[model samples]
Target: MNQGAPNRVVAAQLNIPRGTVGWWRSEDRKVRGEAYEQPTDCPQCTGREFDDVAYAYLLGLYLGDGHIISKRSQHHLSIFCNATQIGLISMAEEAMRKVMPLPTVTRRHKPGCVEVKSYTKHWCCMFPQHGPGKKHERKIALESWQQAIVDAHPWEFVRGLVHSDGCRITNWTIRLVGGERKRYGYPRYFFTNVSSDIRDLYTDTLDKLGVEWTHCTRHGNPYNISVARKASVALMDAHVGPKY
Candidate 1:
């Protein structure tokens, strides 16, 4: 079974019943005090080296739009992506695999989006911020080790956040230029989140990268972080252009 063969295949090969094979395996696991325990390669639990760059990016995605379900029988990390952005979906899946390849990753289609899930309870170990209630309703803070990872891969983290809950848009205005009407376009990036803690984390990373941003109100809510400065937008363009 460890070689990816099902019990039925092992039983047939051994000329034994499937139930008997399963029972023998169960008894062996009980003897080893590992009943119902699944093997994992989690960096946190195993103290194994992993891709910190991918982890930093995934951390941003989790803070932005990801969540973990840690129920008795259900455990997984889910990151919702727009169905139109195939690149983002692929990147999200790759990041999850790079961080922990043992978990099974799958995508489920929703009304207009795709939910990418990694089935494993060890996600809670990686993301200690998981708790009850919505993310915006609870305090979200990264542990020291996670902060170190984000610090090392700030651009990747910012890119993940932008891919999840941020967007780049261009606004144009017609102005009189030397007695002629001319149109000018301004391209800006916005990171919107209801959680102040998450927004603060994004801005803090931006500050470290020397990216200027301001709080912008939209539809009577001041939950938007605007990066409209020419140099800052250029930096963002180089690192994260848009969700695609």
Candidate 2:
């Protein structure tokens, strides 16, 4: 605390109360020159448990618009989306609370997105996909323990993926039958992502769950995957439902 910023900033970053921080850096400690230890546990180091759905959804949020910054002296987790997506912010907050009790949530000033962040050391364990560069350039892999959780709860995992980077859409087309023109619209699900590894993992999970999808694209975009078949869309609907 002494070497860090103000009590407020430290508390916000560390996800603790300012008053508690003051106690940690009390006058007695300051006079005696005692270093205060932050009362927080690391998910990776402590091996704490987490809920499947909440953790998966948080993972989805992380994959879609969230990133973790690890430095030699400091590390933090951040997720940003349009402020209008308040549900996403709330979901991230809920997941943080479930994973640990001391996580602090803060809002930052970004152009149109709402940036909510938490200060925690277990982020790397929670999301091993973190690396030195952007997600597209990184090789994202899941640990055996995490994979076990996903295997037990595949639908929750899909829900997380679709909520963050995928959406339900209606596709339409026109055709001529017997010299008569006809228009038709059909429901489908679309998931867009930049990382091929993530896209493969998503489709693999769907494969394991017996859901069908294809690498369908628009505007020459190769990163698009869709579940367009009526039955498959129904299956996706059953599990993912809606984002909010």
Candidate 3:
């Protein structure tokens, strides 16, 4: 749902058939729009509303695996990755609900198969030495920052290092350098799956944290979105280990 537009619901605005808009309302669905006060009931999370830091903290538990470019089972991998993200988010939500006085965060179900914008940020990474050899250049940098933080704190960190969507988090750390000698602080972040709420949250949180993040622009060699998605699923699957 684009902000400042009369379209209160995204599917309505897009003029997509009601029956085919299912993906828009799926579990762990993230929306993007302009800033507005959160209503009594969350537009995205149904009965569940944003609980400030508690919900934010729950989101911090998610982590991202660096993008991979596997040729085999690419489509299956993407599906699995999206599913895992939703599952991880659900798991975190459940964990938080047990301790907090909040309703369950459920999946969004618009209607049918409408394609909501993917949350994956398309960014490239660059290494100081390689200049070109690095994969997903700047995106890699964001992942690097995340990894660095996770390595140091392991359990208690929430750095908002992510690509374009400005909505990403993980259980691990993404590091940042400090002005002081060898002094660095890990900044943990909570992303609103909803773009409007998240944009508001990002601005408010960043301002509150006194940290600045540069927007990513198109540069360097391009990578396949499908490949990255597959890699992400594989990586997450590997990290989560085996299911009991």
Give per-residue lDDT, candidate 2, residue 120: 64
Clash count list over all predictions: 0, 1, 38
True-structure Cα RMSD, model 3: 18.7
- Give per-residue lDDT, candidate 1, residue 133: 96
Candidates, ranked, TM-score: 1, 2, 3
Candidate 1, lDDT over the whole model: 0.93
Candidate 2, residues 12-57, lDDT tens digits: the string is 8999999987877787588898766565655676676556667776
Write one digit per residue (lDDT tens) for candidate 1, span 47-68: 9999999999999899888999
Q: Which pairs of residues collide in model 1?
A: none
Candidate of highest TM-score: 1
Q: What is the lDDT of residue 6 in candidate 1?
A: 53
lDDT of 3 by residue, 159-232 (tens): 22122122322333345556434533322222322223233333433444434433322354211111123343
> lDDT of candidate 3 vs native?
0.30
TM-score of each: 0.90, 0.81, 0.23
